[model samples]
Structure formats: C-alpha cells, structure tokens
Target: MGIMKDFKSFAMRGNVVDLAVAVVIGGAFGKIIASFVNDVLMPPIGLLLGGADFSNLKVVLKAGSEAILNGDAVVTPAVAEVAIKYGSFVNTVVDFTIVAFAIFMVIKAIEKTKKKEAAKPAAPPAPSKEEVLLSEIRDILKEKQ
Candidate 1:
C-alpha cells in the first residue's frame, strides 16, 4: 500500500503529467509528420527523381527464398530479405528536421516574449507616509540650522 501510494504520488506530479501529455502529443505529431512525408512531400520528390519511390528504395544485402515443404511438413524455414532502406531513413530525417525546426521556432518565440517582458522598465514605488514625514521634518531642521 505504501509503495502504491508512492507510485500514485509520483505519477500525479506536475512534471510527470506534463511529460506524459508531451509524449502522447509528440506521438500524434510524429504520425502527422509521417503522413505529410509519405503522402504529400514524397510524391513530388519521387516524381522529380524519375518516379522513384523512396520507401521502396533499398540495397539488398541478402536474397530471400521460399521455405521448402515436404507434404505440408517444413523442411527448411523461410528466410526474410535483408536490406538497407536508406530512403525510409531519409523520410525519417526530414520528419525530424521539420519537428526540430518547429520546436526551435516555438522556443524562439517564447524567448522573444521573455525578452519583451524583461526590457520593460518597472515603475518606481511610491514613498511611504512615514518616509515623507521624516523628509519634511529633516527639511525643517535644515532650514532652522
């Protein structure tokens, strides 16, 4: 029960909640970015590259073959194709670059707002009644002297 209570407290903390929300939003944002790259961005680029599909672009490392079966009994297991999918990597890179740029812009905007706040000169505080009275008494003494 103590451990459960501790876990609940930890999970309900502001930073933890914020982090969880961020992760969920980040995942959704990544999906949108992925869709943008796959459906919108890649088509024009692919067309420009002579109808090359970037996702399909790969360097085959090893060839694959169908599994050998003897009367519905497996003789040998099927081998999967191994390849370096550099085009997919390129798409991922583009997505990351866009996300990074967006975050940078947001941070820049926040900084600009902070700078504006800091740049403004604060108004001086009004003198207290006691201080005003003290100053008047001092002026009177000085005049008498």
Candidate 2:
C-alpha cells in the first residue's frame, strides 16, 4: 500500500534514526547525572548538614501501614502514604542543574563556533593574469609620467 510505503520512508529517514539514538543516549546520560548527584555530590552535602540521609527523607501522612516485626510486634515505618520528599526533591534538583549546565555549556560552545564562522572574512578573489599585466602597464605609464 502507498500508505505503508510512505510510513516506511518516514521511518527510514536519517533524522528519525538520529532522533531515536539521541533519545536513548539522553536517557542514559540522565541516569548518569542522577547517579552523580545522588552518589557523589549528595553524600558530602548530607555529611556537612549533620549526616542527613536525603533518600530516607519523607513526611509522615498516615503513619504508614503497620509492619509486623518478630511475628508479634507491629512497627510503623514512618508512614508516608501522602508525603512530600524534600530530600529526593533536592537530589532531583541537583540532577536537573547538572544536566542544564552541561546543555548550556554545549550550546555556548556551539554559539562560539558559529560566531567564529561568522567573523571569518571571505577569501579575496584571485587576480586574473590580464589584470596583472594591466597593472604592470599602468605602473610603467605612471612612472614615465
């Protein structure tokens, strides 16, 4: 069918393939940034702020469903059935900041390259042999005058 052929053509486009690859790479890059924020950056920050664990940070809303410990003791693990995680939010903020900064740097570099290209002067056209000969004749005539 013509529709199927058109669809195939669209799917096989280089731009589409490149976009797909970029999306996959972007996902992986996001994971790397998240890990860098959580594992590398947050630890020092948490230590500086009195050993606060951001991931375990939460607000108790319903005091959590009771957990049975030792088959007899009911323990509520700080219920956050409807809680806001400010620490995880901070971690996500850091991740977003890093990714944003990297993208900004890349865009800045690209803009710099574009500016350099724009600033470059075009090469002058080469002089023809006839023009060179004419210039020599003119110089001789001027000297004689």
lDDT of 1 by residue, 1-145 (tens): 9999999999999999999999999999889988988999999999999999998889999988889999999999999999999999999898999889888998999999999999999888999999999999999999999
Model 2 lDDT tens row, 39-122: 999999899999998877888665556455665655644343777788888888889999999989999999999999999998
Clashes of 2: 1
- TM-score for candidate 2: 0.74
Model 1 weakest 10-residue run by lDDT: 94-103
Q: Each candidate's root-mean-square deviation in Å?
A: 3.6, 5.1
Give one clash count per candidate, in the order shown. Answer: 0, 1
Q: List candidate 2 segments past 4 Å from native.
A: 67-80, 126-145
> For model 1, what is the C-alpha lDDT against the true structure?
0.94
Give the Cα error of residue 2 in candidate 2, in Å.
1.6
For model 2, what is the alpha-carbon lDDT of residue 53?
A: 82
lDDT of 2 at 10: 100
